[model samples]
Target chain A: MPDNLQQALGASTNEPTASSKSNLKKLPGDLAMWFFILAELTVFAIFFIGFAIAENLNLVMFAEGKAQLHKVAGLINTIALITSSYFVAISLHSMRVRNDRQAVFRLILALVFAAVYIVIKLWEYESLFEQGIDIETNTFFTLYFLITAFHFMHILLGMVILVYMAKNAYQGKYNDSSSESEFSGFESGACYWHMVDLLWIILFPLIYVI
Target chain B: MMKFWQRYALSWGWLIILTMASVAIGQYFQYATLNSVLFIAIVMLIIALKGQQIVDVFMELKHAPSLWRNIMLSYVIVVPLIITLIYI
Candidate 1:
């Protein structure tokens, strides 16, 4: 069999021999991390569906609420989060290559991008508050605040994870071995950060544009 | 073969282009007299594309185990479909 097919079959069977296991396509990060990601995505899916249902019921209110949002700020936040995800992905590549210094640098860059997201989000929230908008404003604003604030908290946690990964990379913790599992923790952290980015991509359109 | 980082950069470029396209589409729908259902469909389609890029390229799930990869990929599809259903 071709190498790619062989690897796929090995992975599917979940019974690769020791040698084949080395060549099988594997999920990045710990299995537990993937489960965690799935759980988080499920919760966000519920929130997204709820928002859509609410919008369906009150089209005028939802339209008005969306109009009040800062689309430019939403655009910038999307760019920041996507850029941060790219940096985190590159940092993982660096770690795999045992380039600890570059890994740490890229991770720090990712954190900087995330910080941009934080500042913009807080600014947007403050602007809304100044306009006398809050969760109790209406069903539209209620779901808006509930969903975005929940996501904002996730960004903060993702940043903390990035910082921890950066410190570990700088300390050469992930560069100690060629084993992929050695850096699974770093991969898990990167996955969480990307999950944050992924959620924002959908949220941007749902709340601000659509 | 493209270097991993180079591939990632290409994906990032495409993501930014898609983001710009979505914003333009959103702005156009705001003024155009087109069908709102069509607008929602286009926006959701763009969103699905963006989500897929993040899952496959940024998250490096393209070569992952089938079950996990399918689950994430399905999110990119299912959520948009649900939103489209609600909007339309």
Candidate 2:
């Protein structure tokens, strides 16, 4: 049988029997992607450590800058990203099980939460900009904008990847219940989206609450 | 093992509850007199727990190789500990 038909039938039948097993440790998505994820995490970790060090030096300025932030917005965005992460996990599982329809639904839900996060972030940025706050305002604001804006770009990229995944699901590309091998795109995209969420999870407390 | 919704939904519930809890902690610190060190310790602990959930459940690291899993787990545990120390 042709690969597409096999996958389509697998999707309808709801069995992942074609999955191949390996004795070696298996990371989700592509091995290259895992390397990328690790690199991204390391960079963020260093940035966070730097932030902590800076705060230690100018405790009062850091506190004042943090006070200017809208904690409510930060909290809401955190919820949005976490919820989106949950949906992305569900969607990835759905794809693994060849339930492309379920995968599509979950992906759409994930995108909705992502949209909420972006909107709230943009609102926060606008508010800050209107108040004449920018990266150059002070050291704290500079790091704040730098870290978050960099993260915001990742969120945007993750969304684009998700849209591609959703499109693939709609076309039945994820229907290969027999082989987890083919759906690297889905796994990788979901992993990237989760990393975006994970970064925000730490960032929220470090930047806004601390 | 628990069914699909049982596992995923429970994790999702925990994430949402923790988010609320962190916000509440922040609010309490904003109003009450507390040592910054103690407040930071608590916040970092909560952040570590939250990060662990995402790594184990969402990232599927729980099923990955033990080595990779431990390394990922340590990132959450150690980073927060170090950050808390710095703040203190």
Most lDDT-accurate candidate: 1
Global lDDT of each candidate: 0.85, 0.83
* Candidate maximizing DockQ: 1
Worst 10 residues of 1 chain A by lDDT: A1-10
Candidate 1 residue-wise lDDT, B1-88, digit = tens? 4666678999999999999999999899889968988988998999899999999988878777878889999999999999999887
TM-score of each: 0.91, 0.90
Point out the worst 10-residue segment of candidate 1 chain B by lDDT. B1-10
Query: Across residues A82-154, which tens digit of lDDT does each residue of candidate 1 receive?
Result: 9999999988777755678988899889999899999999999999999999999999998999999999999
Inter-residue clash pairs, candidate 1: none
**DockQ-derived CAPRI band for the predicted complex in model 2:** medium
Candidate 2, residues A1-210: lDDT per residue as tens digits? 233233333433333342422232366677778789889989999999999999999999998999899999998899889889899998877775667888999999999999999999999999999999999999999999999999999999999999999998988866655544558667778888988998888899999987
Off by over 4 Å in 1: A1-22, A178-182
